[model samples]
Target: MSVDLETVKRVARLARIAVTTEDAERMTGELNAILGFVEQLDEVDVSGVDPMTSVIPMVMRKRQDAVTDGNKAADIVANAPAAEENFFLVPKVIE
Candidate 1:
């Protein structure tokens, strides 16, 4: 895919960047070179490759799933500036 001067100008406008005529010409060449490299990558064969989360393999650490604060509602409400009926109260904003 080749990038033209008009395409470079359009891209610069869309990105909110101010580019001179000379800068646009330089950018057009650079963008075409980048697209050519991407086209080369499209020809590589990866049909047998599996998607990877990381290049190195390691086991994630596990922890117990039991709840440790199932009955601490009163303790948590005590720290609130204004709590009522086990809920935090805030100033009403709308009628």
Candidate 2:
């Protein structure tokens, strides 16, 4: 679960990044620190917590699932070169 100097160099090469020796050494320590923090997070107890979409307690906002024509056909075709009956008229591509 730790990032080493060799791993850093290998990852940089795989990502097509030019990592100088000095940059790779620096990144090795930085990446190890990040992994260490993530490992610490795994120690927390969350068995009682309910999964939620947001941190704030609130019900999910919802809308009716009724289906209908969006009523925006005319607006959608307003900028077309030729629009008829709220439909875009395109040139025939094949004979």
Best by lDDT: 2
Worst 10 residues of 1 by lDDT: 52-61
Candidate 2 per-residue lDDT over residues 7-35, each given as its tens digit: 99999999999999999999999998999
Q: Against the hidden reference, what TM-scores do the models get?
A: 0.61, 0.61
Candidate 2 — which residues are off by over 4 angstroms? Answer: 61-95
Tell me the lDDT of model 2 at 87: 82
Write the residue-wise lDDT of candidate 1 on 8-94 in tens digits: 999999999999999999999899999999999999998999877678886666898987766888888999999998789999999
Cα shift from native, residue 58, model 2 (Å): 3.0
lDDT scores for all predictions? 0.92, 0.93
| Model 2 worst lDDT run, 10 consecutive residues | 67-76
What C-alpha lDDT, on a 0 to 100 scale, does residue 26 get in candidate 1? 97
Query: For candidate 2, what is the lDDT?
Result: 0.93
